[model samples]
Target: MSDLHDLFLTCPKGLDGLLLEEAQALGLTEARAQVSAIRGKGDLETAYRLCLWSRLANRVLLVLSRFPVSNAEDLYLGVNAVSWSDHLEADGSLAVEFSGKGSGIDNTHFGALKVKDAIVDNLRAEFGKRPTVDKVNPDIRVHLHLDRGQAVLSLDLSGHSLHQRGYRLQQGAAPLKENLAAAVLIRAGWPKIAAEGGALSDPMCGVGTFLIEAGLIAADVAPNLKRERWGFSNWLGHVPAIWKKLIEEAQQRAEVGLAKTPLWIRGYEADPRLIQPARNNIERSGLAEWVKIYQGELATFEPRPDKGQKGLIICNPPYGERLGDEASLLYLYQHLGERLRQSCLGWSAGVFTGAPELGKRMGIRSHKQYAFFNGALPCKLIMLDVEPRQFVTGERGERSDAAPAQGAAVIEQARLSEGGQMFANRLQKNVKALGKWARKEKIECYRVYDADMPEYALAVDLYRDWAHVQEYAAPKSIDPEKAQIRLLDALAALPQALGIPTERIVIKRRERQTGKKQYERQSAEGRFMEVEEGGVKLLVNLTDYLDTGLFLDHRPIRMRIQREAAGKRFLNLFCYTATATVHAAKGDARSTTSVDLSKTYLDWARRNLSLNGLSDKQRLVQSDVMEWLREDRGEYDLVFIDPPTFSNSKRMEGVFDVQRDHVELIDLAMARLAKGGVLYFSNNFRKFELDEGLAARYQVEEISAQTLDQDFARNSKIHRAWRISVR
Candidate 1:
C-alpha cells in the first residue's frame, strides 16, 4: 500500500527538463523528461508536493496502469482492470481525459468514453455501485493516453492544466500560454538572471507574460503560489501539513527580497489594446507595483535612463500572419531594433520571431539562436549582445536600407513538446481535413476568414458549389508568418478543391496601415487597371481601399451577373472597379451605368469598362449611389447594389452602413429598375440580417443560390447576395 509509485508531470512544451529539475530538487527522486513531460517514482505525497509547488508542469498524473491496447476493447479492459476504488470513492465523481498519437484510437472523446465505461462497469460489477462522471470538476480525474498501441491510464493529480496560473484575470489577442511563457522565461535564463540582479524586460509584451514570469521567479513566487485548488486535495493519502509547510516556506522565501529599486520589468506597445491586457496581467500577478508599462510606437520609445542599462530586452513583435501583410511589419521590427540599439546600451536582447524575413530588418547579428516552439511556429529566440557604441549610433539614426525580402522557410521536424505537438498536429489535421473537404466540394472564390480580431491565430474558409464551410483554430498564438504561410498553403488547395484552375483564382491580401499605405494627400484619381489573362479579364484597384481590386469571394456573383446581363439594362451602384458592369457589358447589356462616390474609384471603374471593350454609352458616373438613387429616373433590367458598411469622408454625400439602411437602398435601386428587372443586392457584413418585411414589399427571392460560386463555397456570407423586383 505504501510502495513507491511511478508518476508523471506534464508541463508546457520546452519546460519538461525544468519541471523534472524542480521535482527532483523537491526530493521527488528518479525524475526523467519525456516529451513535454517529467516522470518520477514516489508515493502519493510527492504528487501533492508537485501540485502545491511545481511551476512549469501543467498537470501531475499518478500512473494507474500501462498495457498494450490495440483497439477500444483493449483500452476498456486495461482501464477496467485498475482498482478504481483504491483512489476514487465508490460514491465519488470522476472524469476521464484522453490524449494520444500514432494509435488506432484517434478520437479523444470516444477514447475518454471508453475509459469511463470501463471504470463505471468495473466498479458496478465489483461493488454494485458506479461512480458518477463529473466533467466540470471531478473528485478524481483520470487520464487515458494511447501511444503506438500502448495504453497508460493515470489519475490526474492536478485538477486542472497548470497553465491556468490563476493570476491572469484578463488577456489580449494571442496572449502567450502560461506554461509556454514560463518555458520561454526559463529558457531565457530569467531565474538565474533574477537571482543575480540581472533585470528582465518584454518590450512588446501584450500581456506581460515574460515580465510577470520574471517577476514571479525573482520574487521567489511559486508559479502556483496563487492557485486555489489542486487535484491532490481529494487524494486518499494527501498531506495537508507538509503542503502547508511548503507553501509557508515559499511565502517566507518571497518575503526576503524587497528590492528598493523595482525589478526592471517593463513593456511597451503602440496600441493601447495590448497595453490594457498587459496592465491586467501584471496587476493580477501582483507585480503591478513593481512592473512599468508604457504605450507608444517603438520608433518614439525612449528607454528609461536608469533601467534596462544592463538588463535584457525581449520582444514578440507582430508577425504579418494574422495581422496581415509581412511586407509592412518590417519597419516596425526595424524601428524596434533601432530603438533598442539606440537606447538600451549594454542590454542583451531576445527577439522571438516566426517570420525570419523580419529578422533581417533588425540589422544586428544575433550571438545565439534558441530554437523554441511558440505554439507550432518553429521560432527562433535570437539573442544579441549590444555594445554601447551600437546604441549611441543607432540612437543617432543610422538607419539601414530595408532589405529585399524572401519567403519564410518551411520549418521541418519542429520539435514540439508532447501536448504541444498533439494539439498542433490535431489542429493541422483539422485544417487538412477542411482542405480536403474544400477540394471535394469543388470550392473556389471563397475567403479563408478569421475576422474575430488580432487578425492572427487560425481560421480557414473553403468556397465550393455555392456554399462555404469555415474551419477555425480558436484564438491561440503562433508565429504570424507561419500562420499566414500555412493559410496560403491551405489556400493553394482552394482552387483545386472548387475544381477551378489556379490561373482563374485571385488572391487578395488585406493590407495593414504602414508607411507603404500612408499617403499625406489623397490622389485625385485612383490608378488601377483590368488585365486580361488565361481567357478571363481581372480588374485590380488600389486606391479606394486597403486592398487592390479583386474581391475573390464575389467571383461567382460577378459571373452570375455577367451570365444574366445579355439584353438587360445594367446598373452598378457603389461600384468601385465597376468590374461587374464591365462583365454585364461584355454579356451584351443594352446599357450600363456605374456609380460610386470615390472619383478615384470611378476612374478605376471607367478603366475597367474601357479595358473590357465597353464604350462611353456604358456610362461611368462619379457620384454617390445613395444620392444618385434619389434623383435617377432611368430603369434597368439588372441592378447591382453593393455598399460599404460605413464610410465618412467618402465621395458619398452621406455616410452609409449596409446593415442599417439596406432596405431603403434596395428600395431606391428597385425604383430605378424595370418592371421585370432583377436587382442583385449584396453586402459583405457577415452578421447582416435580411429584412423579411422589406423583401415582402418587393417581389424578392434570395438569389444567394446563383451567387454561390465554386470558390466562395466556404461562407455564403463573404457577401450576402439577393435578387429582388418591384411587386
Candidate 2:
C-alpha cells in the first residue's frame, strides 16, 4: 500500500453520495460514503485527478496517520510520531486546521494549536530550526479531526476549499457556492443537455454561478484547471513531472472543449449593479465566450437560442429568511413557473430553493426532488419536466391552462381562461366605475380593483402609469392550481383592462406578516419613482419593499390634513416617508415636525421633503413617537397620529401594541396640543375597539366614513380613523 494513500473527499452536506460517485469515476478506488464526506484509497495521480475534475468535492485530504487519543498530550504525541522531515522542510511555513471536538480537546482552536506545536517542535528538534506559522497562503496545509476517542491527521491536497474556483471574487448577498451550484447542474441533467448542444439559462442569475458551472461541464473543462497552488505544491514528495503532465492534458482538453463546444448559455439578473460583476466572473472563469449575462427581469426572462433548440432552465431563486420578506418572493416563484411554461415548451427546469413549500406553487410537477444543503440550510432541487403533459394536476394529465405553448399562444390562453375572462371583465367594470372618480379627483395613485370577484383575490391599484397588483393569499381550502390560474388571468388582464404596459404591471402577494417590524431590503435594485398625491410629489419604491412607500388608503386622510393645515403648525406621528407632511407643508403650514423610529424612513422623509421643497418649514426626526411626545414642549394647531398596529423594533425602548397603549399615546399628544387644536388619530388594525373611556375624557368623533374615499369604498375596513379634541 506504499503507492496508495488513504484519502477523504469532503463536500457540502447531503452531497456525499454524489461526491462518492464523482470520486469513483475520477479513479478513486475503494470509495465509500460517510456523512458529508467520502473515504477512499487513491494513488498520487488519482488524488490529482480528483482535485482537478471532481466537481462536488470541497477538499481532498490524504490521510497521514490515525491513532486513538483521549487527551492533548496523546494528541501531540500522535502528531509528533509522523516524520515531519519526510513531507515538509523544517524552515517552511505551515497552517493547521482542526475540526470536531471531544476527548479533552474541548475546542477546535486549542486542538489546532496543539497540532501546530507538535509539527513545529518535531521539525525544530530534527533540523535545529522551526517552521513559521502562515495562516494565509501557507506552504503546507494540514488537517486534524478528532471524533469520539479517535484522531485522524491528514494533509490537505486541495489548498483551499475546492468551491473557491477563483472565478467569482464578487457575488450577490445570498450566493450559492460554486460546488453546490455544480451539484445543482449535475442533478438537473445539464451535462446530458450540454452534450446535445442544448441551451441553458438562469432567470435570476446572481453573479452567474450556475451559468459558469454549466459552461465548464459542457466544455469538458476541469473545474480546477486554473488553480495555481495546491497543498502538494511545496511538499517534499510532490512529483513535478506527473503534475505538469496532468496540467498540460487539462489545458489541451480545455482548448478542444472551447473550440468545439457551441453552447448557448445565458443569465438574466434584474439588478443592474451585478451585471458587470457577473461578466467579470465569467471572464475570469474563461467562460465569457460561452456564457453571457444580461440585465433583464424575471417577468420578461427568455432564453435566446436558435429555433427548435430546447435546453435547461436552472435558477436558485431567493427564498426569503422571514415572513416580512415572503410577501414579495411568492410572486417571484410564480413568475418563474409561468415563464418556464410559456417560453420553454419542451425545456427542463431546475429550481433550487430552501423553502420547499414555495416550490409547490410553481404549478409544474417535478419528476424528481433532490435534497442538498447550502452550508447549513437544507434545500431542495426540484427537477421539472416543463412540457405541457407534466403539469402538477393530480392526474398528471394535459390541461389547456398550464400546457406549454408558444409565447403568443400562452398569452392568448392566459387571457382566454373562463376564470381569466371573468377576472378581466371585473377589472374592466372596476376601471369604468373608478376611472371617472380618480380622474375627477386628480388622484394619481389609487386602487381601481380590490377582489370584487371572489374567484380572483387580487387588489389592483394604479400608481400613476404603473399597476401595483397585490394577490391576497387564498384560503387553504382553495386549490393552489386553481388559484394560480386565476391569478395569472388577473395579471394578463391588468395591462389591457387598466390601459397599462405589461412591463409596468408589478405583482405582489399579500401574506399575513408576523414577527418584529424590522424592515428588510429584499431586492438589490433600490428602484424608486415619484408619484403625485394632492399636488405634492412623493417617492414610492415598488420593488424594494412590500408597501410601495405610500399607503393608498390614507389619501383622504392626508388630503384632510392639507385642507386644514393653512397657517397652522402641524405634528405628524409615524409619518412614514412623510407623505402627509408634504401635503401639509404644501398647504402653507407655518411649521411642521414629523417623527418616526426608523432612520431609513426618516431619510426617506428627508428626501420627500427635499423633493417637494418643503424642507424649509419641516423637521424630519428619527425617534420613537412615544418618547418624542413625552419630551417635546411644543403646541400645535394640527396633529395627526397614524401609529402602526404593533411594533417590536429594537430601536424602540419597548414593544408597542396599539390596542393596549393607544390611550396613553393619545394623552401624551393632547398635552402638547393648543386649546383650539385638533388631534386626528388613526390605525389599520381591523379589530380595534376604541376604549369607551376616551369619549368621556374628551370630545371625539368617529370619522372613519370621511376617510373612506371612493377608491377604498369596496374595502372600507382597510383602516380606522378618529377626530379628537380637548373639551
Candidate 3:
C-alpha cells in the first residue's frame, strides 16, 4: 500500500461516521469524518478495500487537485492544470460530478460541463484520443467541488452510491435508504445495546434494512465488505500486499461473533408486497437464521419471548404523507405506544418521523429527539424509555365524561352534508371539550381551529395556550361562507366557556391561495361582529375572507409586542388590518404608524386602532410600506414587519420575493428606527432562513413563540419571527 495517495469519500449527510469506520477497517488509517464526507490517504488497494466494504456512504473519490477558483474561468483553468493524461486511457469513458457553494457560479450541471471540457481538451491534445462521456457505468468518474471560491477535484473510487447495499435485489415503496438506516442504528447506540445481547425489533420494517443492518452490526460484519470492484483499481498507482493484510484482519474479526447469544433481530410489516422482498434481502445478506421476518398487522404481532437481557424496539410509523386518514394514523401510533407499554419493558425504543403531530399521538414524551435528514425531509428520531410493566400502570381507567364520543354513529352523521349541521355539532363539541380543558388547566387566549376550508374537512383544532387551526375541504360541495361561520362561532364560544371574557378573544383564518392580487369582486358577505370581553372589544369576523378575521399563529407575537411596547414608537409595515398594531397601542405605545397600500385595509387598520381606543394621533399611512421605508425620515422605537412571501402587482415598484431581498429589507427597515429600537420581522415561508450576518448588524433574537401557539405548535417551521434591536 506504499504507493497510496490522498483520497476523499463523500457520503450523504449523517453517514460520515459509519463510512469512516469502514475506511479504517479497510486499512485507510487516516480516514477522518468531515461534516458530510470522509477524507483520508490510501493507495489503489485501499480504494478497492473501501469499494468492497463501505455500506453507509454514497461514493468514494480520490483527490486529484485543490486550488483557488473564483469564477467559471478559474474553475476551467484549475481543471485543465491537472495531469489528465496520467490517468485516462485513450479509449476510456469518463464522467464529472460538480457541486458548488458560496460562489458566483450557480448551475451545478454547467459547472460539470466546464470540468468535462477541460479534462477532454487536456487529454485529447496529448493523445489525439479523448474519453467518451458516460454518465452511467463510466470507466472513470471525477468529482469537482467548489466551496467558498476554492475547488477540490477528485476521482470517484466507488462506482455506485454506497446505499446500494446489493442485498436489496427487490425494493418496496419508499424503502429506507441503507446508509440512513445504518446511521440511525449508530445514533441509537445500537452497538452498545447489541453488545448486551438485547433483542432488536423493527415493528414497521418496510424492506428489512434495519433488521439486516442490525444483524450485520451484531455479527461484527462491515457493511461494504462484499463489493466486487472500485474505480481506483484501474488507476495508474496500485498496491496489493497491504490491502490484503487489512482484509485478513477484517475477516478475522468477523470470524468471531460479538457474542455467543442467539441472534435476536426481528422485523414485522403488514404490507404483503414488502414481505417477500424483505425476506429476499435478509437471505441474500446470509442472515436468514439470525434475522426473522413476520408478515402481519402490528395489532396481532407479539414480541418474541423475553430473554434475561432486555431488548430494544425501534420503528418508523407511516406519516400522513405516505399514508392518509389522520385519525387512523393517530390511532396506530397510540396503539403502538400502548403495545410498547404492555409488552416491552426494560427496553428502549426509537421512533423516527417528520410529522410531529403523529409522534404526539404516541402518548409518550420522548427522552430525546435526534435530528437527521431522511432524504430531503427533516426528521427526528425520538428515543423512548419503556421500563418494565411494574412502572406507572393500573391507575387511571374509564375515559372522561367531557371526552367527545368518538367512533359512534354521531361521527358518521357528522360526516354527512347537512347545511353545516354536523360540522356545527362536531365544531361545538370540540370547542366545548377544548374550553373545558383550558379552564381546568387555567389557560387563556388559546387556539381554536387551524383553518376552516372545504379542503380541510371538519378538522377542528383546539388550543388554550398557542393558536393554530385549520379545516380541510369536504368531498362534496358546501357553502364556504357557512364553513367560516361555523368556525367563528366555535372561536367566539371557546373563550367564554374557558372562563375568558368574550372581548379578550381573537380569531384568525389562513388561506393557501396565491395572494398575487386582490379579489376582483370585493363584497362584504357578512360584517364582522364586535363583542366585549374583560373591558376590551373583541372583533370576530365569520365571513369576510376565505377566512373571516384572525391570524391565530401570531397571537404569541401580539402578546410579545404588547408586553414590550410601553412608551415606544411603533410602526407596522404591510399592516394587513393592523391587529398587531392595535395590540401594541393597547400596550400604550407613544405613537403608532400603520403603513399599507390598500385603502380598504388602511380603513380596517384604523378601525382596529379605534377598537383598541386609539385615534388618528396614531399614524395610518395608505402608501406602499416598502417605498415608505425606503424614503421615510420618521423614526420608531418598535417596528412590526411581516410581508407576503411573494407578490406581483403594479401597486409596488417591482415584483417582491421575501427570500431574495430579506437583507435589503431588514437594512432599510432598521434605518427608520430610534437609537435603541427593535423590529419584529416575520415570514410564513416554511423554509425561511434568516440572513444571520445582516440580522447580526443589530442584536437579534427569534420570537417565534407566538407563531407556535397551541393550534399551530405541531410544526415549528410554519412561520419564523425574529427580533432585531440596536442595543
By lDDT, the better pick of 2 and 3 is 2
Looking at candidate 2, the ten consecutive residues that score lowest on lDDT are 408-417
> Candidate 1 versus the native: TM-score?
0.58
What is candidate 1's lDDT per residue for 1-727, written digit by digit as tens?
A: 3478888888766667777788898768788889988888987656666776676778888887889987788888888888777777777788888999545688898899999999898888878888898887778888978888988888888888887888787777767777777666666667777777777666677777777877877777777877777776776656677678778877776666534446777777767877877788778777776787888766666556353346677777766552234324644665566666566656677787776555644556566777666676777777776553222123222433332235211111112223333334444554455566456644333344443222233333333322122323333466656565444433333333345443333333443223224212222235444444212465653333444455665666677877898998899887877778777887778888888767756766776766656766788887767788899988889998877776555344455666778878887887888888888888777688888888668877777756664434544565677778777
lDDT of each residue in 1-727, candidate 3, tens digit only? 3576787887776667777886787778677889888888887767766766666778878788899987888888899998987787867888888997646689998899999999998988889988899888777888988889889998887767877777888877776788788878877778888887778998889989889989888888767666556565555544456556766876776667633455688889988889998999998886787888888777765577446466778788876551123434544665686677656655788887766545644545566777787887888888877643222221121111222234211110102123333444544555676577566644444454443433334333333332223344433466756554454334433433334433323232334446453322223545555643223454545434443344556767776788888999989987877778888888888888888777866777777668877875688888766778888999989999988787655677887788888888888998888887889999888878887696547888887864575546545666898888885
| Cα lDDT listed for each candidate | 0.66, 0.85, 0.69
**Rank by TM-score, descending?**
2, 1, 3
Q: Model 2 over residues 237-292: C-alpha lDDT tens digits?
A: 78888888889999999999999856989899999999999999999999878999
Using all chains and alpha carbons, the TM-scores for the candidates as numbered come to 0.58, 0.77, 0.55
Best by TM-score: 2
Q: Please give the lDDT score for candidate 1.
A: 0.66
- Decoy 3 TM-score against native: 0.55
